[model samples]
Target chain A: DAGITQSPRYKITETGRQVTLMCHQTWSHSYMFWYRQDLGHGLRLIYYSAAADITDKGEVPDGYVVSRSKTENFPLTLESATRSQTSVYFCASGLDRGRSYEQYFGPGTRLTVT
Target chain B: EDKVVQSPLSLVVHEGDTVTLNCSYEVTNFRSLLWYKQEKKAPTFLFMLTSSGIEKKSGRLSSILDKKELFSILNITATQTGDSAIYLCAIGANNLFFGTGTRLTVIP
Candidate 1:
């Protein structure tokens, strides 16, 4: 009920299908981020939101969409899933200004595109 | 382009051995460097280094940053099997840029 949590801990979807991974944080941190972890690529940031209604693209943003309608929620959507899109998705929250700029991560969602 | 690169992508060692993980980065508007330990699930934060030459220590783990060389190193002394995990390094600038990470395996 506290910290950050992700939904659909594991998912398997067909290519071209749409899938949405949910992330919710109780800390209500100003910054929320979506990242995908892939072998040989590590955790690549897909999108990040500075605050509610303010989002920006990160390193690997193509084929992925993210929205932060509320400070406590940041969801990532795969409009047309591809095999390449199959990976572990992680959501993190952090405060913008503080000595602790480190992010707190969610449990993560393992998605497989078949 | 902002990038974070970790060295010795994977390592294996016996318990009681010492290991040093390296992370190098090239980014604009440098901010802070962070370390994370990832097991089967999500990554857990370890340390965040912003100032150069100051070592951040926690138990047997320690890390230091060098902004001049654009690099950082994580040292673990007397490694144990429980320490086996993927250690990730991320650079914080406009956004956090993470390295591929070093998978450390401590054999008993």
Candidate 2:
């Protein structure tokens, strides 16, 4: 069950160069998200994690950077990449988020920094 | 300030025609109200509304929620052409906020 998997599904870096978008999941979910789907700005949240090392900072977290240590990884880093950071990047997994749940996405990476 | 607003950002029906997608939120303490369906990769889960009016179907898609008019509506009755795509509205207090979607285009 690939359940959730994303990793360089597509990429074309440039600008400041430094991209890393990798998210893996196998059910062991406990909240983990990082979104970025531009064009009218639909999915923003840039980072989140509620387990493993714990992390937070969404709603377009600046340049972006995240790490969940493990519990089914959660990685998203753009360090310097720019060109508005291209777009189309989503990786989600949830089992709980306070009271909401229905998140389980991964089949997107399509970054194009130039 | 947490917010999630989705409206007629775009729409074009045809096929069986029957679409209504709208989501409004002001997040603070409220919880749960989600519906996603974005074709072309990622964005699936379709319904999840916390109480309010109690209506969540699956077959032809359905959803409902109106915590005192906070807003939430997604109903696709006979629409086809794979039901087009781009119809997302998310809101889960404490976190999760997404809107700016609603680009359904079901034509055949």
Off by over 4 Å in 2: A1-12, A15-34, A38-44, A47-77, A80-110, B1-14, B17-30, B35-50, B54-62, B65-73, B77-83, B89-93, B97-105
Candidate 1, superposed: residue stretches over 4 Å from native: A98-100
Please give, for residues B1-108, the per-residue lDDT of candidate 2 as tens digits. 888889988899998988898898888887788888989889898888888999999999899998998998999988999989898888877777888888888889
C-alpha displacement of A46 in model 2, angstroms?
1.4
Reference contacts preserved by each model: 0.84, 0.81
The 10-residue segment with the lowest total lDDT in model 1 chain B: B90-99
lDDT of each: 0.93, 0.87
lDDT for each residue of candidate 1 in B4-106, tens digit (9 for 90 to 100):
8999999999999999999999999888999999998999999999999999999999999999999999999999999999999998887888999999999
Instruction: Compare the candidates by DockQ and give the number of the best one.
Output: 1
Task: Tell me the TM-score of model 2.
Answer: 0.33
TM-score of chain B of each: 0.99, 0.34
- DockQ, every prediction: 0.85, 0.30
